[model samples]
Target: MKADVRLMVTADGSHTAINQTLDKTYHSVHGAFQESQRVYIELGLLAAFEKFPTEELCVFEMGFGTGLNALLTAREANSFQRKVIYTAIDANPMAVEDAKQLNFDDLLATDYLLKLHECPWNLPVEITPWFTLTKQESKLQDWQTNERFHLIYYDAFAPTAQPELWEPEIFTQLAHLLLPGGMLTTYCSKSYVQRNMRAAGLSVEKHPGPPHKRDILRALKMG
Candidate 1:
């Protein structure tokens, strides 16, 4: 799917969003990087990682996008003395060339865009002794794995743009892939999405959103 990618600023002026050409699936009226950091990295992934305090943590990310979340998490993992097996699934993988054009390097302290470009497609590559990245050039529905994730970053497009992904069946599959007490976090706080999360056997909660958003959703697998 060809998308028209354009840059837009977020409310916080901390990150930029790349709007899709054909549809708003990749459209982020809010800053993409900033939102990812606030919702997923800081509040979601990092919080969960700290709570568990594991030597090695496994993470699953739905929309690789600009690889912002993955990079930020990698930096955190390195500082915390934890190993991260970060797996990301993107149906429409961005060309390494296109990703280089983004301002991720300028925004993030680490050279994450380079690392993202360096990661081989369809295979796992180690960025550091503690940080491994696997980029799957496939749709989430089509991908299957035996590895259970300790945390899931549901960064897919909006439900309106990608309705199928928001269904209960999808969440059910994700829930199954998670270890007990595993947590899932997304910027979406839609009622239907939360309801589906519960239907999929996850315990759902609503949390205050980042600067622009009103609320976000978080789900956890019950032991």
Candidate 2:
């Protein structure tokens, strides 16, 4: 899927990609940085760390879109002084040129986002001493990996835009990728979405969402 995207300033003065092909915005219009920090970092990453404090944190992200989640995760790894191995896959990644147009460097006062975009795909690149990134050019359905992750950032497009991605089969595949007690977080909390996760053998929870959103989801794989 080749995505035709245009950079736009979100409500928080951060940059987001508007997918013209799918008629969807990569991040919330209310605030791109706010949503990523709240849903992925605060709720997802922090919770995962508390759940598996002594273990090496391995993360698998379904959609790498603008690399915002990875950027945030890298920063968290540095602050927590924990090593994080992050693997992210996207069928249609934003062009590096377009990624350069983002304002995350300005917001973060760091050049991490630039490194994330410039890193080679299909190989692990150490973004920091505490963080390593592996970007893959693949789709969720097509990806095959023996690695299991402690946390999953399901930052795919909305179900309305990509219904196939939210299917029960997809959740089942994701469930199998998680280690015991592993967690999957998404910015969606629809009834069917929760049901699908449950049917895939995950215990689901509804958490408070970011601004302009009501609720999000965090599903766990219980032994």
Candidate 3:
């Protein structure tokens, strides 16, 4: 389960939200931006870019909490002159006004942050010439999409807090969303979660994680 009820700052001055219901934080306690950069950007996106080398890529993200992943991704797409079709799904998104209070002003442009939260759900909106975003207000189980993705950022809450989401069936569903050779990366490296990913037909690997986190999971679909 996810919570968008309260805002908190991580040790590195990045913003995160605490889910009182699940007793979890949206990002790593050590650093939110750092975690996103390592788990999703470095390992997930950049890795996929090498495997699927193209000027354009499609990405699907779970747990769009705070739009941190999307923001970082958009910046990369613009900076590198690449195109990104970013589709993010969040079951219960925090109110846009409340999200504005988070401490992302220094890391992101104010207008970009505002548009990220204010954009209409279910419709793809162009955030920049290179980045197009489609925010979906639906649960992973309930959401449907015809488009397959080259990268999937599996950034949901920890398996301990949301065990159901870390199940084999959930990973199997994610595998179906990926193109052959696509990868799913997360900051979680639990053995059970790796087993579930393998059971879902992904070849799993563990990579060094950012501060405080020891290992991250990266699972790939077969071509």
Reference-based lDDT, each prediction: 0.79, 0.93, 0.87
Candidate 2 wrongly placed segments (more than 4 Å): none
Relative to the true structure, candidate 3 has a C-alpha RMSD (angstroms) of 1.7
User: Candidate 1's error at 20, in angstroms?
Assistant: 3.1
Cα lDDT over the full model 3: 0.87
Best by lDDT: 2
Assess candidate 1 and give its lDDT.
0.79
Consecutive 10-residue window with the lowest summed lDDT within model 2 = 1-10
Per-residue lDDT of model 3, residues 149-178, tens digit only: 999999888878778898999999999999
RMSD of each: 1.9, 0.9, 1.7
Candidates sorted by TM-score, best first: 2, 3, 1
**Model 3: which ten-residue window has the lowest total lDDT?**
105-114
Q: Which wins on TM-score, candidate 1 or candidate 2?
A: 2
Look at candidate 3 and give me any clashing residue pairs.
none
